[model samples]
Target: MTTAVLALQGAFAEHESRLKELGETVIELRDSDDCALAFDRLILPGGESTVQSKLLKERGMDTLLRRKIEEGMPTFGTCAGMILLAQHVDNGQGGDTQSGALATFPACVRRNAYGRQLGSFHTVDTFADMQVPMTFIRAPYLDSVEDSVSVLSRVDGNIVAARWKNQLVTAFHPEVDSDTSVHEYFLRM
Candidate 1:
């Protein structure tokens, strides 16, 4: 199946490489026209959420993407992508909230829940019942989730990954790691 990776920013290249390694046709979606391409699934790569959100709106892709996800498109989002899909977002400072971009995932996310760049680290965590390498870079975590959401992985008592219907999200970057299990799971979905 063809998978479209949002290429406006962040780790799209890494995700593209991993998907290619798994023998999947990859496409980089850089604009609204790219979003119109026929793809079986989507990967919203980690990046600056605010910037990505603004770009999506300015490029006329926000509505289309949200509609696709809402229409049951299988999607995987990491880090800032998680923030983009969340129904609610806490900026991680004094409980301030920010408007989400897609708002298709049924969870409340906290931006920069683990602090800043210096707070970034790597660790192996349990994901979908298997141990996998997890790399957190200025990540955000799910502060809360709806009952329909299934928790997939957690670190230090914080919810880092979850799945709701066709949507899967992680606060950590799986494409940056050597493991392909996460991408495989998305493929299965």
Candidate 2:
């Protein structure tokens, strides 16, 4: 299955490479126009959420993405990507650039919740009993969740991984470890 990676910026190459290891072609999605094709899934890589959202708005991809999701497009957003997919965002200390998410998943995310990039580290967590070694780089910890959402992983008592409907969001960069099972799951979605 072909999956499109939102390659506007950030660590998209890592995700692309990981997905490629699964024998799938990675398409760089620049805008809504890119979402027209019958892609099996979409990946929004971890980056700066406000910046990515601005780019989506500047490039007019936000509206297109919302429409595509409504049409049942399987999606995965990591880190900052998770902020874009969630329903709410608390920027900590009541200071935030954006408040709400795309509502793709029921969640409340806080950007840089784990501190800064220098605070990034690795952890071995089990998702559905699957030993997932993840690299948490400037990640956000999930605070709240909907009843239907499944907790896939966590770190320091904070929710770091969850699945809401067809959308999968992980606080760490699985791609950084060159792991593609996460991306593969999104593909199968």
Candidate 3:
């Protein structure tokens, strides 16, 4: 199956490399036109959520992506991508709707919920078949989600990974390491 990674900004290249290792061809997505015309599955990589959202808006991908997701196209979001998919975002930064998100998942999210970049580190979690080390950088801790969401992994009692329908999100960077199950799972969908 062919998968596309939104290459508007961020660690999209890393995601591209990992998916290649799984023997799947990837399309580096650009613009709403590309999002609209590209493959069935898409993965939005981690980056500055506001910046990425602005880029998506500028490129006209915002509407296209939302439409695709509603049409049942499988999507996987990491870090900032996860932030973008939230139904609500913390109003901590003066309640700017621009800081708001796509409302893809039924919930709220606070950017940098984990802390600063220096606070980033690795953790081995039990959710995967084997212990997998995940890298969290300026990550967002998932506070609440609807019943449709299933907790896939956690760290220190906080949910770090979860799934809703064909959509999956992780606060940590699995692509930083050598795991393909996550990407493979999306492919299967």
Best model number under lDDT: 1
**Candidates' TM-scores?**
0.98, 0.93, 0.92
Best by TM-score: 1
Write candidate 2's Cα lDDT for 1-189 as tens digits.
778899888889988899888888778988767867667788889988888888988888888887777677788889988988888888887655354436577888888887887989998887655787888888897888889999988788899989877788989988888556677666776
Window of ten residues with lowest summed lDDT in model 3: 94-103
Preferred candidate (lDDT higher): 2 or 3: 2
lDDT for each residue of candidate 1 in 35-70, tens digit (9 for 90 to 100): 889998999999899999999999999999999998
User: What's the candidate order when arranged by decreasing TM-score?
Assistant: 1, 2, 3
Q: Candidate 2 — which residues are off by over 4 angstroms?
A: 95-101
| Model 1, CA-based lDDT | 0.94
- Lowest lDDT block of 10, candidate 1: 91-100
Mark the regions of model 1 whose C-alpha exceeds 4 Å error after superposition: none
